[model samples]
Target: MDQTNDTAETLTPQTVRHSILWRVIFYFATASIALSIVVSAALVVWNYEQQTEAFRERLEDIRVGYSESLGSSLWFYDEIQIQSQVKGIMNLEAISYVRVTDNLNINIEVGTRPHHSDIETLPIEFNGKPIGVLEIAFDRDAVIAKASRAAISTMIAQLVSLLLLASMLGVVVHTLINRRISEMAAQVNDRLSSNQYSPLAISTGKDKDEIDLLIQAFNALSEQMIDQLEQKTQAQQQLKTINLELEDRVKERTHNLQKTVDELNQTLAELHATQGKLIEAEKLSSLGGMVAGIAHEINTPLGLCITIHSYINDNYQVMKRAFDGGGMRKQDFVDFMGMMDESLGILDKNLQRAAHLIKSFKQVSEDQTGEHIRRFSLHDYLHEIMETLSPKFKQTQHKVEIDCSENLWMETFAGSISQVVTNLVMNSLVHAFEHTKEGLIRIQAAEEKGNIVIRYTDNGCGLSAEAKHKIFEPFYTTKRGQGGTGLGMHLVYNIVHQRLKGEIQVEEADQGAAFRMVIPKITEESNVQ
Candidate 1:
């Protein structure tokens, strides 16, 4: 008894409600009810239309049948007969009211008027002359009620037939499919509880159907799942062991890598510091070379001035002695005046030349040393750079030509430009024109598309492909041991790009290495310095 009670308790409301048999019945019943409602509605509407049309035809028939009789009665003043015909029309179920009226004072109405009805009026004429009119009102409610009754009967019959069919289908489905599915589910539950996977053994009928196929497929899937689960379990164990070893190895490797990274970072920082010092040293070295060149240049003019001064002093002494002894002839005095004029003229010219050289040296040296942004004539600045570097080329037959518009002006770091131009000239004299006697260097500047374009070219032994490629790399010198610091072109590249905020490229040239640069006429506001 307790076991039976337990069984009943196990079959909970959820299970009973979700039974396959009941579910199928509910679905079929719902579909049947919906279908009956739609069909019944259509039938009711059709019947109402048919009935309404028939009643209209009946009204016409009654009017036709009674028209001649009523007309004759009206002609003979037979009021009682007209009254009788209207009363008969009221007896028909669809007719709610009837009225007859004549032109000769015969008027009769029968039956009470309904609230909702359709009224039809017939004109009565005798021999093509209007006599009276017959009116009939149809009861809309009565027509609807008749159609509904007929539809209800048909719908009831159809519902009974559909429900019976639904019941039969539900039974067939339960016997064929639901029972086997329930057994399969029970077997699955049993297997789960036992922790043992096996093939499902639900009985199939004599001929195999979808149920048999489903059982076979489930058995095959169960076998595959079991094999996969076993393999997964073994793999998990192996992975656990491997993961421990991998974790230790990762820890060791991470420590070693971090130490190496620290060393590299230290090395890189030192390298950067060294590189900065080298660059500063390179700049200072270039300035020192310029100073040496300018010193040599000033000596020429100063030496000439010294010789002229000595010559003028001797002439002055002779004149003084002639005047003191009273032996100074007029011709001697005139010749002395002429010598004095010529000597003084030579002294004054030499002094001016020395002064001019000094001024050019001062400006170029200041520009090379100080980072000052100034507006200057591009052509004149290039010439000043060449003049300062003239002594370097004095012994050689190399010459630099400047081709720039005098009106082209720039507002930029003139010091960086001076450094770049000086470096390029020195590089040409040292490397480009090393073997050539008469080397020509051309510096061209022009305003193009709102930018100052400078093209520096030298007609010497042009750079090889490899040299050209690495020309601007710091510490990469073609003349490695012969006083080549390798930073000349690198400095030019950095100045043009960094300080001047411009772009420089090695252009294809026929006879020399050509460097083309495009710098903004006015530096960008952010890079004004």
Candidate 2:
């Protein structure tokens, strides 16, 4: 029972609030309209009855008076006569109707327009049986006019009273309910504001109404929410402690990470230094070997020069000794001159060879000057590189063929091109001639695709796949321990990419490796230096 009461109480606010006033309006408005209609109909009927009764009473009086005196009988007439009669009746302020009837059931009302939808036939007791039936149609318009006036007055009064009463009652109910609810809610809010997690103790007592049930359920829900909020608060406090610990851990780890990064940077610097040293050492070793061979090769020319000088000195000494010893002769003098002439020729040839060697070396290592812009024959440039590297080629059965070209370039960086060509040729000699002999090198240049492509191809051993991949990496060399400087190809890559601002690539062929370099053509604006 309590549960059912509680359930009903809980639902009352939703159900009763809507049903009450609408229900009142439904009952009151419907009853009022119906009562007014019924009252109007009854009043109309009563007025009609009174009019008929009064007329019948007057007829009775007239009959008695006629019996006592002397008068004729009365009868209805045609429409004109009935109108005259009705006008007289209306002047007398009596609502009446006249009708003309015969012995048959036919009835003709004595009026221009008769609006009565219902007409009753009754026996006239004048002579006993009905001689002729006369139905006095009631004047309903007048009665309805009075009734409608009464209804309007009643409607206005009812509407005003309903409005005032409903407002007053609604105010009283709403104020009482709101005051009680507000008081209880304020207590709950006070508890909530103080601790924010306090339990609600909304007292519902025993008379559990709708508000009581609502407060009970809300208090339960609020208590549950308060419990969850308390748990969340405790969890947040614990999380704050964990967050502080995590901050310390993060700081510690960040310091360690920073230390590791610093150490890695230092180690990288040292490694770069070591690599630079190793590359320099390898270059120096290759240079030393080349220098020794060049020295030995130049020794021949120097020896020739020395021999020429020595022979001339010896001849002079011999002439002096012979002349002092009284052995001077014209034939001997001619022979000595011939020998001197031969020595001169020999000295000139050897000295020229040594000078050529020196010149080639200087060209290979000379730094580019000024803006590094110049113009020269592409054929000559290619030929010069071939001449410079010809020594290494001479050691083997390999030979490079150059296609002679006329003045071609209008602007270029000569030193950078030289380095690229030098590296390409050196790469070919070092890597391509692994296990073969009688190799061939071809240096070809042509105008292609708005640029010049200088392709240095070889018919020696082709590039291995691994060598092709690592060929451009700095300090990466296939001949890592085999006296390779490794900086040669790196320098070539840089000169082509960075110095000339062009591009160079390599491809291993069936019998050799090919290096293709593409550079922009010179314009007319470039100086022909």
Candidate 1 residue-wise lDDT, 1-529, digit = tens: 5554455445544355578788889998998888988998999899888888988799778877988887787778778787787778777768888888888678888877554336688888777777998888887788888888988888899999998998899889988888777777677666665566688877657788988989888999999999999999999999999999999999999999999999999999999898888888999998898788888888888898888889878888988998999999999989988988888788888888778777878888888788777899988888877878888888988888889888889998788888888888888888888789999999988998989999999998888999879999989998889877887788888888888889998888898788999998888658755
> For each candidate, C-alpha RMSD in Å?
7.7, 14.6
Q: Return the TM-score for candidate 2, rounded to 2 decimals.
A: 0.51
Looking at model 1, which ten-residue stretch has the lowest summed lDDT?
Answer: 5-14
Off by over 4 Å in 1: 1-27, 56-93, 113-117, 121-134, 164-218, 237-281, 306-337, 355-387, 392-417, 424-486, 493-529
On TM-score, the candidate that comes out on top is 1
Off by over 4 Å in 2: 1-238, 273-290, 312-341, 368-378, 410-413, 447-451, 520-529
In model 2, pairs of residues that clash are 9-210
Q: Provide the lDDT at 193 for model 1.
A: 55
- Evaluate residue 17 in candidate 1 and report its C-alpha lDDT on the 0 to 100 scale: 51
Candidate 2 lDDT (Cα, whole model)? 0.65
Encode model 2's per-residue lDDT on 1-529: one tens digit a residue.
4554454444433344554445555666666666666666666666566655765664454334422211112233244543444344334333355553445443545544355554433333334334444444445566556656765676666666666666676566555466456556566545544545454556665878787888778777878987888899999999999999999999999999999999999999999898778655644554454556566767889998997898899899998898899999988889998998988999999999888776765554452323356677777676665655666765798888876457566366776676566667667777777777877789877777777777778887777788778787787777878977677787677667765667888765666677788877763333332
